[model samples]
Structures are given as structure tokens and as C-alpha cells.
Target: MSASRYQDLVAKVDAKAKEFHERYAAQLQCKKGCSSCCQPGLTVFSVERLAIREWLNERPDLIEKLKAQPGNPKACSFLDDEGACQIYPVRPIICRTQGLPLSFKVNERTERDVCPLNFEKDDVLALPTDGVLNLDLLNTLLVLVDQVEGGSEAGQRFALNVDEVTRT
Candidate 1:
């Protein structure tokens, strides 16, 4: 039952992201081919990995396509050569929030962040609270949801190798 909460959270975030992307379409430089943020060696929490596995199980073709590709070493393994995500629908929260204005804390100080290519020279801090995604809050909620799903266990917390998703 708690596992479903994760989906709810994802739904909320996805809606917010979609709305923001639409309202600020001109400000956002994020396009389908843009993948500067899709760095290699990214790891997801166990709950997120479970979501990915479940999503792939429903679409074995994507799994086979992922397996056939000689993954890019410089970018995420799930990214195709053209820089599109193979698992966009079930991408991690971090991936979903990418290229958006995000507020997070660093050393107890609040900082504003956005993709360098996006909203250039515009002060993200000045944007209303609703305009920016509260990353800290989002992360906390995800951790709590993960805990409820039994993902807080020492070894089950995170998948060290994201590639493991393709094997099964």
C-alpha cells in the first residue's frame, strides 16, 4: 500500500513539472535532444528501482532495446545515442526535476539552481515559491516513502549499479 504513495508523489511532481514546462516553455531550454544533465553513474533509491523494473516488465521491448544498445559511457546508460531517455515515463524524481528551477540547501544556506541553459540571467530566487521546486522537501518525502516501502534497509536502500535494471 505504501508503495502506491510513491506513485502518488511521482504523479504530483510530474504534474507540477508539466505545468511549469508549459507555462515557461520559452524560458526552458530543455528539449528532447538536450541531455547535459543525464550524467553517467547515476543511482536511484530502491523504491525508484522497483518502479523502473515494474515499468519495464510491462514493456519488454524497451528492455530489449536497452540491452541491445552499447550504452554511452559519457552519459546515462538509459539514454539513447540521440540523448533521449529510454525510460522517460518512469524516470527518477531527480531526472524529472532536471532543467527546472530548484531550491535546495547547502551548508544550511538556501540556494537557487536551474539548468545553465535554462532561464539564463533570470533570477530564479525572485520567482514565487510556487515557481520553483523545493528539492529538499521533495527529497525528504521520497526518503519517507522509501522507508515505508522497506527500502530503508542498509543494503536495499539504493542500487549501486543502475545497469542492474536491464539484467532482470
Candidate 2:
């Protein structure tokens, strides 16, 4: 699986996220070392998993650093003791979008959400529609990218979470 397509998607996501963060800086409490949203059980597309693996492979120092730290079962394995992500530069798309306003459909109903720490001073529904990321669309794009990257192969998909990424 290749990461070129996934990296393209990441670029788009990062642009959108940057715009939202800039526009909502005052309302967002997200900052360095804040990992309330970095929880366990978060899975990535095969493209993303491959990307993480490739990134780590290129950085043996980071691998050693991650190994040196004590992993917390309660938190994401990539999270450091200081709550910073050990693989921040190559983090998955979902991680890139955390703390941003997101909209997705569930049971034929549109659901919107944000990090509770954010938008506390304003109503989520009151924000401009363009201000929120279309999570469904993002996920669809990610899946397509994954499929193109050979993630459709048996057992190579995103069945494992970040913890397994560390182990394997």
C-alpha cells in the first residue's frame, strides 16, 4: 500500500482543519499537550496504518523513544507521557480532525459534534455550516484511498487500532 494518495487527502484535511482552527481559535481549547480526545480503540485506514508504519521506519530514533516510554493502556499508544503524540507529523486523518466541528449522518439523521472543551461559549448549531467538516465525506475519501492502496487484501485493513501498530 502506498501513502501518496493518502498524503494528498491529508493535505486537504489539514487545510480545512487549519481554516477552522484559525476561525475558531477563541472558542477552541485545543493546544499542545492536550490529549483528552486521544483515546484508545481508534483505528485508521490501511493507507493510514501503512503511512504510520513507513514514517516510523524512517525514524529509528522515534521508535526508540516510543519504546523507552511506558505505554498507558487507557490512552492511545502513540501518546507520550506529556500527552503529545509520538507520531504527530504522520498522525491519521481522524486525529488531524479532532477538536474541529464535524458533521456526519447516523440512522438517516445528521449529527454534529465537537470536542466538549470547544464551542462551549457558543452553540454548535449556530456556527456557519461551512465551519464544520463533513466527516462522512472525509471517511468516504479515506476508504477509497485505502482500497486503492491495496488495503482490500485479506486482513490488511484497519482491524487493529494504534496499540497494535506499536506492537507490530
Q: Which one wins on lDDT?
A: 1
User: Over the stretch 112-131, how does candidate 2's per-residue lDDT look in tens digits?
Assistant: 99999999989887777798
* lDDT scores of the candidates, listed in order: 0.81, 0.80
Q: For candidate 1, give the lDDT.
A: 0.81
Pick by TM-score: which candidate is best?
Answer: 2
What TM-score would candidate 1 get against the native? 0.87
* Window of ten residues with lowest summed lDDT in model 1: 152-161
Residue-level lDDT tens digits of model 1 in 56-119 = 8888787777778885677888887789887888888989999999999999998999999999
Candidate 2: worst-modelled 10 consecutive residues by lDDT: 154-163
Off by over 4 Å in 1: 1-3, 150-162, 166-168
